[model samples]
Target: MTEPGDPRFGATHRRFVIPTVISRATIGGSTCQIVVGVLSSGSATQRSQRGELRAELLRIALRGQGLADPCTVGVEHDANGAPALSSPHIGSVSFSYDGIWAVVAISPSEGRIGVDIQMPRRVSPTVLRRFAPDLATRADDKSTYSEFARRWAAREAASKAAGTGLRGELLRTVLPVARAGRDFGATYTVLDGWTFPALSLAHKD
Candidate 1:
């Protein structure tokens, strides 16, 4: 397995592809970059089509991992509005999307895996204040958006790796990651009998 700081996942696999409206897409190595996309239908922002796309994407991604046959992936909503996979066969996976950029991951019994990706968005003082309230104060910095996207992806990836959504399951759980760097995980919120590895996924395309 590649170490967290391994140069492979960062400097290579600069670009990737995802099916039209897939649950997510991940294409990056240990030292490369990852790309993700979501498929949706209807006028709703979080279209249900994304759920379908995510499932298919999951199967495709896990095909070589030995857990693709009985593949059964679907979107499930938790109390905190966090999305999770509904499959007993899936040990762990990550899901993230930023309109044009989306990504997800499937974990194997003997390897580290997690991914996240987001697209760039228009920023303004008032809009950023409400839309991305978390980073409103840091809008002046050019890397603020990237930082927000990375942190969001990191938290979601870490949570997915832990198999728990926001709803207090990730309560008191905080992920440490670079606002604009690769290999975001070195440690995670360790639980009683669960410990998560530091997985990384970032993109710009």
Candidate 2:
């Protein structure tokens, strides 16, 4: 039987995998590429398997950018557990996964970029108030869950790009607006039926 890391046991062996270029958008001076795929189920060690899947996708993303040896690229995480390329800096990357879907965002420039995927779900008023008061104020009984998902994704992406990871007052302060200078800015788009909020931090001289 094939082990976990074997190419035959994971996404590499899947025939219906999505392409590396799901969508591309220009943020500031950086062009961010979004890559997405669906995860296979039935793994006894789901967490480790998912991590390996994500790493494989990152390698594919790096390879698309013309990296000489994508397999040698290493992913390092900050204190907040936000991932970055270890050395020979090709670009900045951020990713998120929900259910069976996973997505990766790559910025082929000095600017940092983040991406998040959120699925629509029931959110209570109190939970909304605590997490996203600005959105709560406009919330009504008829509110669509997709709106909340998008808002959550936007904030999460902003925090990831800022290297803060939703800590402290980040969720409240990081709005979907572009700040004056050297701040994280976010934009929302739908790729492969997933709503993603892509973030980019302007490079400071």
TM-score of each predicted structure versus truth: 0.47, 0.72
Which pairs of residues collide in model 2?
none
* Separate clash counts for every candidate: 19, 0
Per-residue lDDT of candidate 1, residues 40-149 (tens digit): 33312545555554554555555434554645556566675544457634444456655544455554322234455544444576755644566778787767655544
- Whole-model lDDT, candidate 1? 0.42
- Residue 143 deviation, candidate 1, in Å? 2.5
Worst 10 residues of 2 by lDDT: 1-10
> Which number leads on TM-score?
2
Best lDDT among the predictions, by candidate number: 2
The whole-model C-alpha lDDT of candidate 2 against the native structure comes to: 0.59
Model 2, 1-205: lDDT tens per residue?
1011212224353633333334555555665666666666554248777777688788766765778688888888877787788863688888888776677777777766667777677678776777666667666643545666765666666556666667666645534432223334433332333433322222211
